[model samples]
Target: KDPKACTILLRGASKEILAEVERNLQDAMQVCRNVLLDPYLLPGGGAVEMEVSHRLTERSRAMTGVEQWPYRAVAQALEVVPRTLIQNCGASAIRVLTSLRAKHTQEGNSSWGVNGET
Candidate 1:
């Protein structure tokens, strides 16, 4: 195909991918809202934050199908939540990324670590 045609194809594909991501994010947000509103879900403030962070990570992973991007998305989302929530949770948004990175490194799947061979 022509170069212009290839570019257009790639753009279209990327748009589709992003649209799917948005849909998944919406579904995840709804689930998170439900869990947060449920009195039985998380009894304590710390538990609530931890659960939210964990859910965000899990949802991001489940939606993205890739390790890195999903983790990034989770971190970004967490950053947008209220600071009080993060403070009370005893975990920051970056902590989620760090944990994921550490897990990947331990599993020999990370490329940014010291060895740089995995």
Candidate 2:
């Protein structure tokens, strides 16, 4: 019974909800522990995926006829992440994805992510 330690009592209207809350809390604690063990974070909301897609698309442009298709295909596949993010936010996926791609193409702009709050 350490007074300084974090503690909380959660109440749910149903057993299922309480179990879900417990699971979520446990997951959050695990994430905190992992963060303490190794402090690092990947770009959220498809930023890294978009960056990879941009690089692959750029690389495809430099290759010969047949060799470029695979790079292009993979680049297109990776775009699904950001596109889904935009669609979930009730925005035009095509327009936002085009903008996101353009942003990632610029200098020192690899961290640009899809705006999920829209």
Candidate 3:
């Protein structure tokens, strides 16, 4: 669960690949904002609620797309994207999602706990 380790490993990865990943992520973010926040897409409260659900689903899809390219590029670069990156990304993502959930729970908005608590 050491983020520094992940950072160092990523640093060793080609800067070109890393830059591509960053660009992809930025594009995904833009798509998310466009689809989720467009006033014309949801002009009412119930519409907004449904749009939020749709947006969340699409966000997952977007993230998958963003990760896919870098994953393939990394695999090509190293002949295999290290299992470490795969595991570390999964772990780090879970940690981040759980932390956000905890924040929401503390605010009396949700209640969920992740495994791997230490």
Query: Regarding lDDT, does 2 or 3 come out ahead?
Result: 2
User: Global CA lDDT of candidate 2, please?
Assistant: 0.90
Residue 58 displacement (Å), model 1: 36
lDDT of 2 by residue, 3-67 (tens): 86877799999999999999999999999999999999666689999999999999999999999
How does each model score on lDDT?
A: 0.49, 0.90, 0.43
Estimate, for each residue in 79-106, the C-alpha lDDT of model 1 and write its tens digit.
3443444445565546644554444434
lDDT of candidate 2 at residue 25, scale 0 to 100: 94
Q: Rank the candidates by TM-score, best first.
A: 2, 3, 1
For candidate 2, the per-residue lDDT at 68 reads: 100
| Poorly placed runs, candidate 2 (over 4 Å) | 1-42
Q: TM-score: which is higher, 2 or 3?
A: 2
**Worst-scoring 10-residue span by lDDT in model 1:** 109-118
* TM match of model 3 to true structure: 0.24
* CA deviation > 4 Å runs, candidate 3: 1-12, 39-118
TM-score of each: 0.23, 0.64, 0.24
Residue-level lDDT tens digits of model 3 in 1-118: 6464433222327889888877777798798888878834323212222233333444455566566565444323431222233344455644544353334334333322222332
